[model samples]
Target: MKKIIFSLLVLAASFSANAQVDRSTMPKAGPAPEINLSKPQSFELKNGLKVIVVENHKLPRVAYTLTLDNPPIQEGDKTGAATLSGALLGKGSTSISKDAYNEEVDFMGARINFGSQYAAASGLTQYSDRILELLADAAINPNFTEEEFNKEKALLIDNLKTNEKSVSAAASTASRALLYGKDHPKGEFETPAGLENVTLADAKAFYNKAFIPNNAYLVVVGDVDFKNIKKIVTSNFKDWKKGSALPAAFTTPKNVVSTEIDFIDMPNAVQSEVIVENLVSLKMSDPDYFPVLMANQILGGGGEGRLFLNLREDKGYTYGAYSSIGNDKYGMTSFSASASVRNMVTDSSVVAFLEEIDRIRETPVSEKDLKNAKAKYVGSFVRSLEQPATVARFALNIETENLPEDFYQNYLSKINAVTIADVQRVAKKYFLSDNSRIVIAGKGSEVLSNLENVSFKGKTIPVKFYDKEGNAVEKPKYEVALPEGVTKQTVLNNYLEAIGGKDKVAALESLLMVGEGSVQGTPLKLTMKKTNKEQFVQMIEVMGNVMSKQVLNGDTAVITAQGQTVTPTPEQLKDLKAESAIVAELNMLDDETIKLEKIEKVDGKNAYVLALNEKKKAFYDTESGLKIKEETTQEMQGQTFVQTVLFGDYKEVKGVQFPTKLSQSMGPQNIEFTFSEVKVNEGVTEADFK
Candidate 1:
């Protein structure tokens, strides 16, 4: 009772003191906290493999990271050899079956991963010895069987096929190719032909040549004795042979002479991928490193950045905009600002990016931005120090990047010391606005015209066309001359005849489609039902749970997503009513607002383009007379969304042909649905539209 009374008195006194103090001015920030960095113990093996170990007994866990610091090698034709070899590693060693190896790792609750030049393993500290032994065995004696090689190669091919249609992937490839010559190691992307050229022998050769230990560093962190770890590493890796020394000299690629737009055409794209980049020679050891870091942070490092504010929050052109500056010890890296934006605003987005970048380069950042950026960095850096692996990484960077031992120790101080003038100076030097490549991978038909006319500061940014592979090409011809006597009604009639007959389509009273697809690997079931009486229902289910549902019943249209149901706005209701018909093509034939535009390529085949409205377009195969694709743009909650649907693999249902495969894109995610069952005038009932 006495202690409680004393504590209450103390609390009352503290409040009285606080009430007496001034509350008008903001308090000054205190000095940066000191970081307690653990000095890693090190040893070297006979095979020239250096091992560094950091001890932390706070947690009963251990991690080992082995990195081969080899110089970059240009794999001209066999570009995928290294990648395939990396995937083949960590599967099993000579003495262990793949299944047995994986089972043991899983049993121990450990993670083991391998790449072309690196291997990492971690688990409970009690399993440290076995984990290290397994890591060394897998890294040194990988079982590169013919079966595994074939499987990995086929999977790689499938991945490349997916990337071929990805606008962001194309932009990344084009940006690298434009910034660095395609022959350079930094720029060469693996192609399907390259994958075909890579034989099993090439993968083995790359493994033998590149995965050496002479220039390697193994960082062991977590609860472990340095002496025991050194002995274990020596015992396991002693037999591994060192390869020949890598060549130190390599040529760095140069940026373009002047700012120009390098546009790659992706006709199926609903949005544009834009990148503004320039080459820089910044390294961690450079004096401008801290300044450049602060500059990029103020420009576009996170949600509070100028780019994100201007492009996403203010302009609403994209969901997010970001920039990154790379630091390479090899004297070549890029400073890039990038965004995925709406197709129609691609040109405006580019201008916005340039403006923000130029603004940062020309003007000094405010003191508030500098202080906030420093605080962000200090907080993140301090928080990261809680991980034992971060200490190991810092020690490794000091060794690999040739930095002073006290570099990370003085990190916060350096960031704090960076003045606003220093940020502007470094930004001006590294963020080259005058000589940069604006690489845009987008729909040329929608963006090229406005992009050609985009000018900044009295200078036009010339638009140069390129294929997806970054090869220079002639300007794309978006439209072709229509064949003689082709009209909107003629195309509609051809589609109606191609599906079945106009009479059969009109005779169809109701339709139901049940399909399955996956989003981010989660399986989903889609059910769509429609009737000629202007009643429709669409539902998506995951694991027997309804994810979303939409219903159009006579005069009432409503949507329910994740248990929240809302009535559609008048405009949305009009659009839903337009799409509610069972036979949309029959209604479209009579709708005078829909107009036949021109012929363009859809999936490498000619298709007649039709403008259904200002926000919607439809594509029909010119030869097959089938509706192939449809694109719609909508505005919801002050944000614009572009959704695309691709129809294919038509199968007969009763007397009319219906699409069995549907590929739909919701923003950046693509879901391909395969219809397993279709019922015509049999399954759908009036109650389904409730």
Candidate 2:
């Protein structure tokens, strides 16, 4: 009873003390907190491999990163040799079988991977010794067999092919290739031709010459003693011989004299990829580093940045906008602000980007912007210090970038010291908007005319054309005249004739299609069923779990997703009922609103574009008379999205031709579904619509 009375008295006194303090006055910002960061221990081996170790006992695990800090490799025709060679490593060593090596690593729940010039391994502290030994064996004595080389080469080429039609990929390559000439190491990109030229001999030669111990650093972090790690590293790498000195210098790339637009025409692009880039020479040790970092943060760092607010939030041109500046110790790097925007606003987005860049350069950032940016950096730095690997990385960076001993130690203080003046100064020095290369990769038919006359502040920017491979080319002839005497009804009749006869199509009672594809690496299956009775069912599954289901029966339409069922409005149900036919074109043929808009290219083939009302369009091949593509405009959350579907690989089933391949694009995602089964008048019943 006495203790309870004492506790109540203390609580009452705390409340009385709080009531006496002033609550109206705002508090001043405090100084940067002093970070109790632990420094990593370092040692050098006789073979010139430097090791840095950071001990953290909080987690009974360890990680080692072997980075070859060498100059960028300029591979002419064999541009992908280093990447392929890196992938070839860690498959198996001369000492262990491939299956055995992978099985053991998996059993230990560890990850071991290698790249062109780096290797990483992590496991529990108890298995650290074996992990390091396996890593060393794989790195030093890689099994470079012909079969493995073929597999890796094919995989690399496959990746290149996959990105062949990607607008963003084309923009990225064109930007770097223009910033730094294609001959420079920083500008070189992998091509299928390059990968095909890369023989096993080239990979072996690159590995022998580039993977040297002289310029490599092995960073070890997590639970381990410095001395024990040093001993084990020494014993494992002592026998590895050091090669000749690596290349240390290269020519720095220069920026353009004035801002200009470089446009690449891709007829299939649904949106435009805009990139404004300029070459700048900056390094980690430079005094302007911290200020440039802050400037980028305030300019286009994240969703809060000015570019995002203007382009996405205000103008509604894109999903997001961002900017980044690269710092390189070897050669000059680039500063780029970029976005993927609707094709109609490609030119407008470019101008908005330039305005933001110029605004940051001309005006001094407000004190609030400065404080917020600093707070973000300070918070991020303090949180990163909690990770033991951060300590090891800091040590390695200091050694590699020639930074001072206490560079990361005073990181937060330096960030906090940056004033608005510093941000404006760096902004003017680095953000070279006047001498920028505006790269726009998109459909020439849609955006070319607008981009040709794009003006910022009454000064029109000249537009230059280039092919997707970065080669200068003449302005493409986008207009292909429609053939003589072709009307909407003729096109519709041709499509009906292309896919089975009208009589056969009308006689069909039911149809079912089963297709398989993946979205972001998740297995997706689509099952669609339709009956002549105007009942339709569509189901989408991810990994065999139904993600969404939609059913249209008679005049009612319902959609089920995430345990919620929603009924479509009368207008939406009318549109859904129009698609209840087995072949939609059969109904479209009777609609008077459908008209032939024009003839445009769809995947390099001339196709007839039919405007199916204001919200949808369909493209039909002029020669084959088959419906090749469909486009629809949808509104969700006050934002508009254009979804596209490309149909190809037609095969005959039940005496009617059906599309076997379907590629769909919704916003930023593209899924290619390959049909495995097509049943006509079978595999579907009235109960399926339930």
The prediction achieving the highest TM-score against the true structure is 2
Best candidate, lDDT: 1
lDDT of 1: 0.90
Model 1 over residues 647-681: C-alpha lDDT tens digits? 99999988899999999985688999999999998
State residue 163's C-alpha deviation in candidate 2, in Å: 1.9
Residues 334-380 of candidate 2 have per-residue lDDT tens digits of 89999999888888999999999999999999988888887777777
Clash pairs (backbone) in predicted model 1: none
TM-score (all chains, Cα) for each model: 0.93, 0.95
RMSD of 2: 2.7
